[model samples]
Structures are given as C-alpha cells and as structure tokens.
Target: MLHFLPAPLRGLIGATLLALNTLACCVPLFSVTLLKICLPFPAAQRLCRWLMDFIHEAWISCNKVWMNLLGNTQWQVEGLQGLDYQHSYLVTSNHQSWVDILVLQYLLNRRVRPLKFFLKQELIWVPVIGLCWWALGFPFMKRYSKAYLAKHPEKKGKDLQTTRRTCAKFSQTSVGIFNFLEGTRHTPAKHAAQQSPFKHLLKPKAGGIAFVLDAMGEQLHSIVNVTIHYPQGNPGFWDILSGNVDEVVVRFKELPIPAEFIGRNYDQDEAYRLQFQQWVNQLWLEKDAELSELKQRFPGH
Candidate 1:
C-alpha cells in the first residue's frame, strides 16, 4: 500500500492514475460508441452498450485499486440488500462533494446497473468525458427559468417534451438514472443563504426528479434513495484524492415508487404536482434525520 506516502504524493499519484485510466478506457469506449452511432440497429447498439459498460466498470475498478493503495478510510454502509442488476432505478441523493460521485460509483457498481446521471445539455460538449457521457446514454436536460419560459411562450410545456424524448432512449436498457435532489452541493454559506429547513441539507429541488418520474415512470423499477455522510466533514475532491478523508458513511434504501405517481403528468396535473412535492419533502425529512443520527454515531461532526 502507498498509504504511507505523503499527502501531496498520494494526491498526485491518484490524479495521474485516474487520468490515465480514463484516457485508456476512453479509447475503446469511443470506438464502441462510434460503432453504436454508425450502426443504428438495435442489436448493434446493444452490443456496443455492453462493451461500453464493461469498459466503464473497468475504469471504476482501477479507481478502487488506487484508492485502496492510498487510504485506509473506514466505511459504514447499510441497506444494500435485495438489489437487482437487471432492474432500472431512479437514484436520488443528498449532494455534498464531488467525492460523492466516486463513493456511489464504488459502492453500487455491479450491485445495480451502471449509473448515468441526468446532465445539463451543455455538458455534452465537455471534452472527452462529455462524449463518454453521451455514448453511455445519459440524458441531457435543457432547463429554462420561469422568466425565460414566459418570454418565449412557445417553450412552455417543452420541458416535459424534452424530458420524455430523452427518457425514451432508456426504455431498451436497464440503467441507473441519478439526480442530486438538492441540485447543488451543500455548504454552510449556501445553507444560511437559502434558510434551509434542514440543518445539514439545502432545499430539495422537486421539479427535476418529478420530470424524470413523469417520463420514465414505467421503465424504472423503483427509487433508490441514497444518503452519504463524511464523518470527518464533507471533503473536497482534492481532500479525497490526497487521502485526507478519514472515514465515510453511506446508507442506501430501495423505495417503492408510489402507484399514484405512475402514469401521472407532473406539469399538467396541479394535484399530482403538489402531492409529489409533499412526498419528496417527507423523504428529505427522513434523510435529514438519518444524517443527524450518523453525525451522533460518529461524534465530533
């Protein structure tokens, strides 16, 4: 183990290895992606997807090696039972740090289908990683502000159209669709600015997930509600890379999607929209309480 190395050296080595891993995997991944694109047949697309998923999993496994070599962080995880890889899930989490991505990637890799986050439409242009995301079938959303929507009256109801059109691509495969309910990482400054109701979380944005359910409600098997905690305080990506993070805790619960939510239009139906937001609020309440319990369990958080 290189855990004995200095933090700077560990971080440097980790970053280098991660870059190399991504570059190496992207080579084959891009090739398969090209093949998938050039040939639009269902069988060809399926083959390419399988190849890409394997490459992605390999990339994640390489990260595991480097992390194990660098840090001895303790892990406390629960509620990971009865997960099926063949099933699709709408995964939601409390966002805190960039490391949360790696944690989830590490924790649920093969336990469920590989995760594909709902990304912004602009992210599809983000160099090599962007292409990879596109190849992997991550849905890109074109979100419009209320004012913008009002200015362009024609754009109204198009959000649902975009969501449904993008989500239609997922119907053929079982992939984990992830959304950070808070929409951004939580921070003390942000908490104070927003006057957050929860001590630890920012306000949960209900619209994104609501749109997701409205589109893929039939395809998704269930909602996988995940709560991640950093007992040593939320670490920056660099902190994790440098082996400064001492311990991590994460909880996973498979929540059944409410039957009423299925086949419901979140934007068109006012009643469904209100009821869905309430459901999300209650879920957030439980997640906040769990964070509190975890904080107490670890002490000095």
Candidate 2:
C-alpha cells in the first residue's frame, strides 16, 4: 500500500510512525534511566538494566515492524547459525549509511546479546537518546588526535584508561560490542580521496578495535565479522523509509580472537600492532571480494 503512494506521502507516514514509536519508547526508557542513575546499589542497578533491556528490545521490535510496513527491501542474511545469546561478542561491520544500524538491529535482535556501540564521548549529551545509550552501557570514548596529544603529553593514555574502566562493567553480563571499522560512511568521493586499497571499502582503522581487544579481550567469546551490501545502491534513511531501497545483503562470519592478540599493547608494541593491522587488512580484503561477488549476483535493483 505504501508503494503506491507518492514518495513524499510515504515518507511522511513512515517517518511519523517511526517518530511515534521512538517517542513512546524514549519516555519509559528515560524514566528508567533516571532511576538507574539515582540508584547506586549494585542489585538495584542490575534490576534497572534488566528493565531497560526489555524496553530497548521492544523498541527494536517496533522499529522492525515499521520497516516491514513501510519498506519493500529484500533481505538476504546468512551465517547466524550456532550463535549463543549468553556469550559476549565483538561485532565489526563496514559502514555505508545510517540504515545499517537498523538493519543490524533487525537481524541480530535476539540472535545474540544486546548490541552496545562504542559511541563518541560527546554523544552522551544529545538529549534523551544519549542518556538511553548511557543507561544501556554503551562505552563512550574520548579519543585524542595525534596532534592534540602532541600538545598535551600528560593526557596521552587517558582514553585507554577510560576504555579499560568502562569495559570492566561488561564482564558482569553478555553483550555484543559493535565497531564500524571504516570509521565513517562510504561515499564515492571519499573513497577516491582515500585512495583506498580495497575496491569497495575504505582503509580499516585498527586502533579502535585494537583498544577494545586490549580492554575486553579475555571476556569476548568470538569476533563476528558482518558484511552488509546494498544491492540497490546505498540508500539514505529517508530513501529506506520511503521504500526506495529494494534489497540488502548481510553476511556474518564468526572467528576466534587469536590468543596472541588478546591483552596485547596495540599502541606501544610495534610488532603486535603490525600483526593486528595485517589481520584486519586481510579481513577487509575478503570483505571487498565478497562485495564484488554480491554485486555480480545482484547486478541491478
């Protein structure tokens, strides 16, 4: 029914429904988050987290419903076999558009533990959703650039210290840590600017995931490599909402974290850093080839 409507009308309706769903969830989510913040006791905090997870899962379910109702995208997802929700996972994927987050949530909802993203520290101030992210245990990272660190030499290892402290909390529960290895969305102009070695991807940044491994390496059960391909071209959020995107392919592959890579110094140890970079680059090469095959199989929208 939405497909027959004008694009603007479909977009309005879809956007309205999504906004309503978000508003509905955010109210209760914020309320519980406030309660969690005030309650300092461990048991009380655990209870609040459990309640927040229930609300968050419901929100994801509602968004999935909205996706089904408004979008006509064909989804081809694989490699979800043998996943256990009780185990912690480090999930890495290529970033294309904002819709990737929704797609991941739709696919990984109950298949694994709840997804927790490594958000920029500044995002914690973005109104209600920021608080929600905080209550849900997303690690907020304050990354310093090389130039900035050069100026303030004393603040050098502060970010890693923060990561270590935040990750320690995840040891109490099963969680899925998501990292976008490309660090930004892919665009033709941006890809050309980087002179990326991979035909379909930007250069993979190893530092963020490397920091995560250093912090939570012993606790993480496996690394989940997810490859997402937009067969109809990578669409914007509005395009997806308005039913413009036709197909999306998501493939998942779980690999073990090498023992040598765990608990290693990613910044100070040059040899370990080189080895880790090689491993991530190899994964990117494989993903780039996989994207090529997918494009060949699904040539056009």
Candidate 3:
C-alpha cells in the first residue's frame, strides 16, 4: 500500500505511473490525428473523433486507478443527479491549484461529455502534446488585447469571429467546454492585490463565458457551475500524488443559459454586458459563501 511508503517514494511512484499512462494514450492519439488530417472526409473525421474519445476516456480511467492506488484523499461530492453525457455543457469553476483539473476529470468523466479547454493559440506549438490537443478538438483562442486592438483598428472583431467558427465546429458533436472565469489560479497575494470583492475567489471575468454563450448560441444546453474546495489548504499536484492531501469537496450546480444572452454581442452591447457581469458576480458570491461553510464543517481537513 502507498500509505506505508515514504512521501518521496509515493510521489515518485505516482508521477512515474501518470507519465507512462499519458505516453501510452498519446501515441495512439497522435496516429489517429495524422490519419484524420490526411483523409479529410466527414466519415473519417467522425471515426477519428470516436477513437480519440475512447483513448482519452481510457487515460482518465488509468488516472483514477492510480489515484485510488497511490493517494489517500477523501472525495466528498454532491449535486450530480440526473446528468446526461450526451448533452453539451459550458462548465465553469473556481481555480485554486493545478490539481483542480485532475479533480474535475476524475469526477465528471462520463457523467457529461469529455472536458475541452480553451487554449491560447500559441500553445498549439508546444511540441508533442500541442498537436494532441488540436487533434482532440480543443479550441485554440487568439485574443487581442485592447491596446493592441486599438493600434490595429481593423482586427477589433477578429477574436469573436474566430470564436464563432470554433463554435460551429463544436456543434457537430456533444462536448463540454471548460472556462475558468477567474482566468488564473487563485493565490493569497493575488486576492489581496486585486482587492477582490469575494472572500474566497478572485473577480470572475465575464468576457470569456459571454463570448462562449454568444458563439454557441442555443447549441449549448446548460451551464455547469462547479465549486472545488481543499479544506486542508490548496494542495499542489505533488501533494495530491504524495498522499498528503486528505480531502477534496466538489459540488455541481446546473443552470439554464439565459435566453437573452444567446446571440447577444458582448462587445457591442453595453446593457447585455452589465447584466451578464452581474449574473456572474452573483454566482461568485454564492460560491464564496459555500466555500466558507464547507471549510467550517470540515475543520482540520
């Protein structure tokens, strides 16, 4: 049992197994991607997608096996009733540590569609994994800052145009899109520096989710709001692998995407932007309170 092993040995073993699992899955994924690229037919694309999904689900299954074998963490989860894997979803959560991604993958793996993240366009060049992500249909977003857009003038609406095209691709299949509304992981220093309005979260940015809703239109079924808490403290990935983190709490709440938000231009419409921001802020407020209660109930977790 990993409990009897030294912390260093536990971490080393867990890391090694995870690396091996990733490599095993990625090799076949790369091959399928090449095949999809070369064939460029609708049927071939669908076949490649099905194969990639199988490989990815197997990878997640392997990760779960390693977690149960190597980690001593207790999972407390709630609000997952009546989820349909075939439906499309827009999932948002509070970002605490890098380990949150693993937690989401573990909990939501077949309850909904496979989780796909919005990656920066530049990440597509990050070597082997980059092509794997592209092959798996992760949308690469090219965002132009306001200052840069001001200088270019002609490229102002380019980002949203790209988002619309990406959404069109996603409409062909059921998929779950993940957006970390805070845009970055949380830290005490960041919390203080931003003068954050919430007790436990950084300010939620409205633009990303707004664009997603507008781009996806009615194709997206519902919003899955997730709150992840580590009552012992936010643990790094190594802490989880080393059997140091004892408990993780995850809660899921599903809400309908308000009809008014669909097809509304977040960049051009002032009223819609304010209303969407207010809605997101309210969600953050509730999450902050829920986190406080979770920590209180599981003292010394």
In candidate 3, stretches whose alpha carbon ends up further than 4 angstroms from where it belongs are 125-127
| Local accuracy of candidate 1 as per-residue lDDT tens digits, 67-185 | 88888888889989999999999999999999999999999988888888878899999978898888777777777898998899888877678778878887888888899999888
Candidates 2 and 3, the one with greater lDDT: 3
Estimate the overall C-alpha local distance difference test score of candidate 2.
0.87
TM-scores of all predicted structures? 0.96, 0.95, 0.95
Give the better candidate number (1 or 2) by TM-score: 1
lDDT, candidates in the order shown: 0.88, 0.87, 0.88
Sorted by lDDT (best first), the order is: 3, 1, 2
Best by lDDT: 3
Which digits, one per residue and each the tens of the lDDT, describe model 3 over residues 1-301? 4777898998998888888998888889989989988999999988988898889889899988888887777899998997899999999999999899989999999898789888889999986668778888888888878899889999987767877777788878888989999988999999999999899999998888899899886888899999998988899989877777789989999998988889999999999999999999999999999999988887673
TM-score of candidate 3 against the unseen true structure? 0.95
Q: Each candidate's root-mean-square deviation in Å?
A: 1.4, 1.5, 1.5
